[model samples]
Target: MRFGVAFLGAAMMAGSGIAHAALPAGFTVTIEDAGVKSASGAYFGGDINNYGVETFDSLSTGVHSTYASTFGGSPISGTYSNLNVHKADQYGGAGGNNNYAVAGISQTGSYAIDFTTENGESLTYFGYWLSALDPGNVLEFYKKDGSGGFNLLGTFNPTDVIAKVGNNASGTNPYYGNPDGTFVGQNKDEPYAFVNFFNETTGFDRIVFKQTVASAGYESDNHTVGWWKSQGGNEVPGVPEPATWAMLIAGFGMIGGAMRSRKRISVSLA
Candidate 1:
């Protein structure tokens, strides 16, 4: 890929402190379990997860994406040129009930950062703007401790905001093409979510997101969300354990003492 030399330089300068860290090297945002009913096309809901190694580049030139639904399957990856990002507040139809082929840039390719604390812990912090959605659409946060379970941080519902809507408007549902000649649901606008994380003490490696399907029907509610990672970013520093640091410090101290004594003896002999 083509990278601007100046930008890369700036990225390194900003991320110099963590150059030797063992933290994540990048970040990824993904939507999971996202879809509405294939028949009624009512309310839609799914999970959005932004996980991956923490990096400085992600905070600078990361990418955000929303894919057309494939019904109940994973989002199909697309070419970089084919990816489109839009503002979230530009969509969401009239009264917050619509479905059409929607896509846009959420956060304008900005930074969503995660970091490791001094205690050898990891935390994620992200920020972004969005529009177009029902008055009740919500985004929930979660974290995994390398265990089999997930912890819910909280829920962020877009109030007085906008969101992207997916519909089968033109009858050409790329995700779920109609058997006859008419699509059921079409995605409308693009909604973006920016996330931030911190307090990475346990060094966990997974994150999950879930959207609540409120009162809207099963088909055309709050669903259809996906994300892609922007390559390269700042790396979180890996702080050695207290014991490890102590050992290294002690070893260095011994070496320093030996060198000083040798210099004194050599001077006396001369």
Candidate 2:
């Protein structure tokens, strides 16, 4: 696909430090162009233990401090601060369709979601559709430290993805057009992408979205979470655990050899 080269260079330079500083030793980030559709298709497989998507459709329009919902049959409760749910058309970079999305508001230009599953399992994967990317928008992942504090695991933004994969060249006129057709021709100057964060070791449980500039907001939709599987053959460092290997073998046996042919990209942090 085609990308804006000039913008890509600038984004790379600006986001370089954030990527290095925020990503922990064992975490990786993957970015994919959704291309006129949602990225929901990428969230499945034997590798994922449990997964869910929060569409924000059921929530009322306003600031919510606590929200609970089930995604993909898994129960998830989230605590938020200064997070507001707005109808799609209410925001400039948002997708259309009478649907809804969440954004950070007020003086902070930031908001966060601290997630806890009903079973209290650690989350290994987090992803979302980032629309109308801006330099001010920043996303951070964190894990709970032993002493009731949190440790930052990674920091990312749409610009980082553009620096890697470039920008969407095809699709509607605006590269970042809403696949749902709600807000066509809007945010033409901005780029959009589906970003996935995976932790190879211990996983994270909290996500924070912020806008560094005053009055700007962080807008996103289809927040997804899952338990991810590592990739490797019989090798040592990257190999999956025995239990996971067993699950993969069993899954491949049932699904047939065709599933093994599907292509996937895995990025490891340096």
Candidate 3:
């Protein structure tokens, strides 16, 4: 078989150059300020290599919004670019949880979001670009109520995201993989980021995510936040059942009783 030196060189150059694109274009993103209301922190983790950033070209598909907050709600729109996305990996002797380590970008601390939807309802999904697969970790989603209350929506295992990144391949020095539960340093299989219920009816907006840490001999803890936009308006799915209202009223009654008892105790003490 005849080998072409020129073709080899060209291929190498192309592969090398794939990662060196300019930062993402300008965007005026909204992020909430601290002390307003926030759920958990969002993390954006990734690493840059000789080839360039380990980004999935399809990662930013569809219309999505990003936000940041300390407690929850209180959102603000801001700008996000390729430069600001967090990317981290194991380097040097620093080793704790290989999969335990995750890079995070926040909509908080000057973070928020805005997105568009054509239909009456819009769906927001969550994910990230996996430089490597970490089955030990899971992605959690939280939803915030109007008065700054939070509820855990669901948790996603790496298995759910495996399909999206399977075809993605990385040309960088280090590689990342998209295989279900496989972690390789340089695969371009970027995972999707989302919140299952950010529709108009919910009247709820904003989202955040963090990486889970688990290792046999070592334990790791990490958190991060991501932002999303609401279709905007007073609408959502699923009606609150009569039982739901009963529970809510009963809960309030309990609180009221507690308050009255506290007052009586204060008087007795005086």
lDDT (tens digit, per residue) of candidate 2 on 1-270 = 112434333433454454435577687766554443233444545433467777777666666655555654556656666556666652322346544444433433667878788678778877776765554578888889989989887787544544433434343323344454656654444555566677788888888887653344566777778776542111112334434433322221221222111111122111
Residue-level lDDT of model 3, residues 1-270, one tens digit each, is 111233322322232233222112121112122111111222212211100111212222211233221211212221222111221232100121122212221111221222222232222322222233332224333345447665544443333323222212232211222222222231222222221222223322333233322220111112122333322111222234533433322221121111110010010100
Clashes of each: 71, 0, 65
Query: What is the C-alpha lDDT profile of model 1 across 1-270, one tens digit per residue?
Result: 111333322322332232222223332222211221211111111222332221111111213332222223332211111122211112322123332221212212111112223333333333222222322233334455457555544443322111111222343323221111122232222122222223223323222222222221101122222222232221222333434433322221221211110010010100
Best by TM-score: 2
Please give the TM-score that candidate 3 achieves against the real structure: 0.28
lDDT of each: 0.25, 0.55, 0.24
All candidates' TM-scores? 0.24, 0.68, 0.28
List the candidate 3 regions with Cα displacement exceeding 4 Å: 1-127, 163-206, 215-270
